[model samples]
Target: MSEPIPTGCEGVDELLGGGFERGVVTQLYGPPAAGKTNLALSAAVETAARGDSALFIDTEGISVDRLEQLASARTEDVEDLASRIIVSDVLDFDEQGEAVQDAEEFAEQVELIVLDSATGFYRIRRTEDEEAGDALRTVAQQVTHLLSLARKHDLAVVITNQVFTDPDSDRARPLGGHTLTHWSGVVLRLERFRGGNRRATLEKHQAKPAGETIQFKITGEGLQSVEDVP
Candidate 1:
């Protein structure tokens, strides 16, 4: 078995039994400003800091400025840190799929792969219920392909997803439907808390019981795990 990749956030690492497991797909689903991107960047920084390269696929226009800031905080040489991170800006669903599928060329170089807002383009094109469902189906298939690559190459795949609130229950659910849920090996739901803190709930894990939560904060340095979080 491959060793887990540490995410740099102590609390999250502990919750995940060190960090994200290799050869599986991990999904971080939540609402806007829930610190999903922060966590993703934190993982990338940790991966790069360990002398391993990371592939970051940006779908929702993730801020490069913010990434640079985080990278600066994590390492002394921001340029070297940036060099290890291969970023691909994907504008549409087709491009997103292509980027993910074509990542094999970098498989030996990249140990961790991140897709920020994997469902962003699908959500944007979803005008009607039928269209939304169809888009989701397509996206799910693409995600499965990505996961297969992860398993084949022993890469850790991390995907950030957007969520929608159910009108009847007022409960937030990941946008990609049950198919997406089933594809992911680990599922975490991020939420905002008081005092600029964030909460991450481990909703599904292949080896562990669900409903475990962890606390962390996005700081000037990066995502830090809060000790004895209340």
Candidate 2:
């Protein structure tokens, strides 16, 4: 079997049956300040430590400073790791679609691809456009194209998404509707936990059982497992 991509958290890796598997889309959805981006960055740090490249398609203006800080804790040659990460910043729906589609070309070269807050652009478009179905469909198509790239190149695809509370259950739901939930192979839901830690729940997965949760915290070094906590 191929080696699974680590998220830099042993507890999370165990919950995920040895981290994320390649050739599938992994959705990390949560509310604001849930450390979703931190998890993605931690994964990138692990990839860089392995001497591999990863692509970051940023829709929410990701912080390279934070990335450098995290990477520095893992390796002394932070510049070498930072150089391997290629970031593409997209400001609008059209540009976001283009950036996602562009991942196909770099699929073979990079071991991981992250679209931090992929639904942010779509959410904005929906609010502004009166007839939003057409725009949403276009974005959906772009996501499908990226999934194809993941399978074709056997790369780990990590996509972050926003969440809204369901009125009925009072639980958080990923805002992309069925268009996202149905397409993702693994869906991990994150929420704030006690003691400044974050809880990651296995909402959906192919191999792992659902409803399992793990604790992690965003430390100066990156996402440190709860076991490492003092």
Candidate 3:
């Protein structure tokens, strides 16, 4: 049997069959202010609190101050948790490649690695004139390499993605397309409720079946589980 994975959120862990699967990529996708970053940060904090190290790769210029704020706002103790979490930012694919290598080397001591908004790297690497197809291929290569590294080091991988409206259809979709969905073992979608509350819905899972959606609320103390509203 595969080793157990722990979800940062309590209720989410129960919904995700004990937790996310180890040595696999899990994608968290949502629109702006949809609590994607909040969820990722929560998971990272939980991993660290459990005596495991976690690495956060910030590509969208998520400032150190912002990270500190999130860390401090964690449901768990911040000072204790911050020591176990490391943060890095890369400007392009080349930088990302190097960062991945460094993360692999560090994974010997770290338990989890998170790429906060991986799509940002793709956007930075893509030239204005480049076709979507070419850019996607480049992103695919990088993600594949990272996945390999995660597997080799037995590190759990978490990636956050931005959502976009699919003009051709009514539903929302992740920015990177099929390459992302195919590579990730789990895909979660987050949105805001009528009262500005957050909702975390499991959209897809390759490792196991995710039968129902769950509700979550964010506060100064951090993410808290809520009953699923009908």
lDDT of 2 by residue, 161-229 (tens): 998778999988897868887778999999898899898999899987899888888888888778534
- Model 3 CA lDDT for position 173: 89
Sort the candidates on TM-score, descending order: 1, 2, 3
TM-score of each: 0.95, 0.94, 0.87
- lDDT measured at residue 17 in model 1 versus the true structure, 0 to 100: 78
Q: Which stretches of candidate 3 lie over 4 Å from their true place?
A: 1-3, 63-77, 124-127
C-alpha lDDT (0 to 100) for residue 51 of candidate 1? 89
Candidate 3 lDDT, 128-170, residue by residue in tens? 6567677678667766766886788777788888767788996
Candidate 1 overall lDDT versus native: 0.86
- Which residue segments of model 1 deviate by more than 4 Å? 128-130, 228-230
Give candidate 2 regions above 4 Å deviation: 227-230
At residue 129, what lDDT does model 3 achieve? 51
* Superior candidate under TM-score, 2 versus 3: 2
Can you give the lDDT of residue 92 in candidate 3? 73
CA lDDT scores, all candidates in order: 0.86, 0.85, 0.75
Task: Give the TM-score comparing model 2 with the true structure, all chains together.
Answer: 0.94
- Give lDDT: candidate 2, residue 128: 86
